[model samples]
Target: MLVISSSCKLCCMSKSLTAWLSIGLLVALTNNAVSQTSHPNIVLIYADDLGYGDTSCYGATAVATPHIDRIASEGIRFTDGHAPAATCTPSRYAMLTGQYAWRQQGTGIAKGDASAIIQPGRVTLASMLHDAGYKTGVVGKWHLGLGPAEGADWNGKIAPGPLEIGFDYCFLIPATGDRVPCVYVENHHVVDLDPDDPIHVSFKTKVGNEPTGAENPDLLKMHPSHGHDRTIVNGISRIGYMTGGHRARWVDEEMADRITSKAVAYIEENKDDPFFLFFSLHDIHVPRVPHPRFVGTTAMGPRGDAIAQTDWCTGEILAALDRLNLTDNTIVLFTSDNGPVVDDGYQDEAAEKLGDHQPAGPLRGGKYSSFEGGTRVPFVLRWPAKVKANQTSDALVCQIDLLHSFATLTGQTLAAEAGPDSHNLMAALLGEDSQGRDHLVQQARTLSLRQGDWKYLEPGRGPAINKNTNTEVGVAPQAQLYNLRADLGEQKNLADQHPQRVDKMKATLGRVRSESSSR
Candidate 1:
């Protein structure tokens, strides 16, 4: 028998116990590493109407965006990134549903009282993540219409909205800043509704006796330049008419704080598990009312102040990530819904105060245009573990592709019909590959196709400039074509010079849009 003295046996046993403990520690670490690598927390921070040249990281000189720039410094910054559409409603719809917003008819810029555009039971990005055991939540501007299409019962539960579209939790502004029903919707009900003063909204006719901009301009703190001269809410004229729900009305300046608080709370609550947070921002949008702390942050007035506020909100989220010890395991994506537009509806001095600041950067057009500035937006991805730091990639990616790419990342098998327009570009997103979206469609009123270095714009019957916005509407009577590599600004049209290329591209686009899936 291999027996020894009692003291000797005890020493050997101790040595064996130490070896097993070391192995156990190693196994635990390895498992943690594997888990983090596989299931990274995703936070898609979508900014509303923020331009390509809005952030310092994207080449803006007027404002500094350290937190946004930090994301670019830590990970990949995509040069050729695009929102699905030029407008917020369509672009956001496309991003969440993984389908072209143009595919549906009701996806134009939505009103405050419009019905839910996205139907239930559809496989959406949030639904996909939810199925993969991720706690999905969305915060901020949700312009994709809520409740029923025509008559949304404001007093009742607002369904067929974000929750119906796959989001587990949602706190949203039902529409834009200029729209009516100026209330925050948390999940299904209004934040603080009163039974006595029942809310009623109407887009066509004046529902209540609320003072309107057109009727009474003297009461407004900020004046409307165009279609926003409708009903008055919070001293600002909105697009629709609202009778009641005074308590539920939101303060324009406190919007950033209110929305960001909900978003941060969501993160704090779900720190222990994997979560997908679509933090849609409302700053840099219309009625450019920044919080008191951010007032006069820049010489460019409310527009500049809003940009600073947006950066701060972004910083707050990043700080929350750090506080929760979820930095390395988190995949934070920063992008805009579309390009920027000055003087959208309100007289906000966004254009008058502008000295040398270029909101669209080197791009030609702004929002609601077929130009690069309309859809091409700032895209930054930060994943400390997977993506290398301080890298710039010229991959042609779109927000529409996020659906399939995330599905592939989480090992969730998507159905053949799901994410029909989305491509699995996880490699490109992580900075492993440069080629992304060989052919992408740019949408405004008319659709433009970008294939390789060539772009073809289909002719449409509209004015050269949107007189209201003072932006090039990108509408023309003649077919337009350009070599993007040759003309990045899209100044010289080569449609007459190269009809063959346009024809080929037009055919290619038809195939892309008509086919079942682009994968």
Candidate 2:
């Protein structure tokens, strides 16, 4: 109508199209960035007393841990992985706080009535993740202790525990299954506790009128081989004494099912949000009492049967993730607290029925030993979205580094004083790097250092062998050295041959001890 030319009309139309296309491209790029930066759900499955050779994937022919193997086949299996210590309490402590347990006094094997080891104000793995906008929950063994300096009230609220330390929620086995107060504590109170009955526990002296294992041997379904002979609950005697709270006490056979159910429920409830789950399993530990359905499933008696039970629990969790379509964005890690111990306390035919079954595989010593088997444990990590499948890594990874690694993953800054011993091995964990921690410290009754393939053990004063458990404690009157590449079992002592190396390692150990932080 205004006598405009055809070329002018075409130019205006082309410009309009280009402007619309630019807006569409901008919106698409923004969406892609948001998806990339979104945090993934983390699930850490911690197995108690599971050794490097305990699973079929790790070469245990007697036991087939299909569920554990599935994780291995799906992600990365670390051969040189280790726990923080050879003992339970120390290992758990280091993993959570990112500091070596040896730095703190009273971090020894906790009694059933021991006070809280981790204080409220201190930084913890859960606290760090929680601050990073993730809902954290720990469901299973929490042997780190509870209550205040005076100890927890078994009948009332147990304060200054997992909740105080930054966990949004907790369902815990206050101590080891073999210890007293053999009940589950959910959040702050003892689950299913009866107010009228009351509860009392003691490690020093006999408490209550409960019949002891030493006195009532005939009443026990499984007798103690050594020290676990105090309070009898559910026909099994445990370390320390406990009275009342019968309703809250957990049954030995039904424990696997009970705890697994709770863990699964937590995952389901928190599926909508970015969550961190610490699913600590109580399997293949002492007093290995598998359910009736799993009793005769293996030839290694209760121990092998318990391994099978552990696999089932793993399957349950995996199935839940699959059902909820959360598998792709979740990172799952499976590992143990320490090495294997065959007759820890109860008489469970773990030794006698053993036929060609090697718990620690080719590694020497176990549990409380200072040898390779003591600290070296099975570690598998799986992240379907970001990690490649069927990978095996020999990176020198330790549980202590989890705090710093996770902190890096969430893009949070840690205080200078926090995670003193923890290193950021995130690249190694994700299989992006092969070398992890040039040198690592392994703790048992004494301390040892691992630099590359060489190992150094400082001379310490203790029995060379644990007489009761029939295990090598790795104590001696002289310094010890070994090249793990040539001698995996630590059969050859090359200390005399390599005097200079021993001196260097000894000096390094001393330096580490003197320093306030190793990070």
Candidate 3:
């Protein structure tokens, strides 16, 4: 995740720690002896609310993203990359668990104060990698939530977070950028939270005289269209209440730079050894606040500016790898958590200033929508000398495949219980045969499935168009199916025209969801 580049001192300290950690890990690597499997440094750069066409290489013309585009130009750009789910938390769950997110009930938009989603003792990708002698770390955007089990102390151990799940170290946001308990969570505890000035958060009501966007419109720099209007921070009203932890509170603009710096430092310190870094970026999401230096960087208001900031963060990370001479050995996977949306809560001139900027590229729907735009996102893999450069892959891939792909790459054998839905996409990542899965299931909080060229949306009750943003949710009664190959826009529904195909897809989606649910 991209963070503002303002905190140089903190970055320097992190860099120092990384150097020692790298040495220590290298020593461990040497002592452990090389296993039968050859492991490479893995860095997954996950962007927030990024659409398929947001980057220049992906046909975006609104803002030139030379930095983000460089990944596609340098290595492989996936044409049909997708997030397992349309939202952040579910997509992340799929990535780590290698399973379809929809199978897990209520794996939709999680609240900021929601309890830990991933159960403790569940073998995750991080834990597997750690067991295989790779140092794992997650920086930024831990929307998966944090807790110390039921009725545990906040001042004590916060179990079932990143560290508990398998990451050796973690520096993450307690929830989302728009959510409350708006503080940095480094490993177990909230960063710099003074016991004297304890933090109290609430989404339902406010405890103090915290001015809300609903009541104090004059104090808000960006107005919320729906939800995301509560306690004010840095001139913007967020989604929940935050009473204390003033010193640890992060600046929205500098978020990108800070995350990038931490990611780079982690890489630099672990350059000589195998390490896994999940660099979750917070940009182009709600409350799009670009750094002052990048305020007017694009014509698309804060959204475009935030996209530019994301690109800049990408450039910094790539530069770090090049500087450390690990570009050739390190495998970098860059993709977004979900699709894009112009107006998600905040009124940042995103929709108004969006002059022909197709955030979803050629696809329909975005973000919360069940359309292709909600899950389809730009995915690029870069590994100099190891992966063929400037290549395009039409491999049908999903974030859920990462666990198995990484496991195969590292030659780690996981029990059947772990990553049951994950399939190895190692060949696809290496730019080998382009053909991916024959049939794939997709989600949008709602359970949807896509097989080859056909897309299916299960019968459900949901808004066809989000009234606040006007993005299609791809929901309909009597089961909707579309031939995506013929109509990328999904303007034509073929449920009546192609009943046989619809039945087949329905069966496929049902079987997949049911099997996973049973597991």
Best by lDDT: 2
Writing each residue's lDDT as its tens digit, candidate 3 over 228-262 gives: 87898888888877787687788887887777778
Local distance difference test, each candidate: 0.90, 0.92, 0.82
The parts of candidate 1 lying over 4 Å away from their true place are 1-21
The 10-residue segment of model 1 with minimum total lDDT is: 510-519
- Clash count for each candidate, listed in order shown: 2, 0, 15
**Model 3 regions lying over 4 Å from their true place:** 1-37, 149-156, 517-519
Off by over 4 Å in 2: 1-38
**Residue 354's C-alpha lDDT in candidate 3?**
92
Model 2 residue 395 distance off true place after TM-score fit, in angstroms? 0.7
- Give per-residue CA lDDT, model 1, range 96-127, as digits (tens): 87888877789999878888888898889999
- Which 10-residue window in model 2 sums to the lowest lDDT? 30-39
Which one wins on TM-score?
Answer: 1
Q: Give the TM-score of candidate 3.
A: 0.90
Models, CA RMSD each:
1.7, 2.4, 11.8
